[model samples]
Target: MKTDDAVSALGALANEHRLAVFRLLVQAGPEGRAAGVIAEKLDLPASSLSFHLAHLTRAGLILQRRESRSLIYSADFVAMNDLVGFLTENCCGGASCAPAAQAASKKRRAS
Candidate 1:
């Protein structure tokens, strides 16, 4: 994930409803949730859910498929991992000073 791609993904998630939908889909896992279920769970209208889903889809944060007449949505974990990688790639200035490295150090100490 390049900086531009990461920025776009982050920008798409900046909305309240979009963030809620993303979180819900992440919890739903690979099986995903139906559009109706998402709407009900979030107390949103179908149209509103559709709008958020479209945003997430365009951001490559989620995938949608047609299961019979229903639309199923799931998080795109690969894309998510890439985004995280991009954000942390330069952590600690290529040294071991980053928080992530520090967390790993603590784990080793605890052991």
Candidate 2:
């Protein structure tokens, strides 16, 4: 992913509600969830959910599809993986990052 793309993706996820929506879609897997399901689970109004979904779509972080009359939303896993790869490129200067990941995990539990 280009730097600009990464920036856009990160910007989209910067909001609390957007982050929650994205995570929910990711958890939903490739099958995704309908727009109504998302709004209900997130306790967000339709207008608000539409706005966030549009934002994530523009950022290429999520995908939308029509299933009958329902609009389903799912995470763009390829884009997500690309963003992760871009961020972690040359990570630890080519050294293993497992140690760092482990440390971070431990820190999270300690807090």
Candidate 3:
């Protein structure tokens, strides 16, 4: 990810509800969860959830799809890993840090 993209992603996650929502989707796996379910799980109002979801979506940290009558939201794991990479790419100022994000990204791809 570029530095600008990283800043956007981080900004989206900086919120309390947005962070919780993103973490919930990550735990939900690639299949993700519906908007209502996210609201229920995070105890957020529908309006607030909509706003936060839009913010995350615009930041490219999440993906949204129409699953029939429901709108499914899932974390953009690749984008997530890229953000992690951007943050830790200079870890220890070494040529390679082999951060957890890389490992997790590989594992996720394997599945």
Model 1, 26-95: lDDT tens per residue? 8999999999999999999988888889999999999999999998999999998999899888876788
The lowest-lDDT stretch of 10 consecutive residues in candidate 3 is 92-101
Find the 10 residues in a row with the least total lDDT in model 2: 88-97
Report clashes for each candidate as comma-separated counts.
0, 0, 0
Question: Which candidate, 1 or 2, would have the higher lDDT against the true structure?
Answer: 2
Error at 80, model 1, angstroms: 0.5
Q: Give the per-residue lDDT of model 2 (tens digit) for 1-111.
A: 899999999999999999999999999999999999999999999999999999999999999999999999999999999999999898999999998899999999999
Please list the C-alpha lDDT of all candidates, in the order they appear: 0.91, 0.98, 0.93
Q: Which runs of model 2 end up more than 4 angstroms from their true locations?
A: none
| Model 1 misplacement above 4 A | 97-111
TM of each candidate vs. truth: 0.84, 0.94, 0.84
What's the C-alpha lDDT at position 56 in model 3?
A: 98
Candidate 3 local lDDT, 1-111, one digit each (tens): 777888999999999889999999999999999999999988999999999999999999999999899999999999999998898777867766467669889999999
Q: How many backbone clashes does candidate 3 have?
A: 0
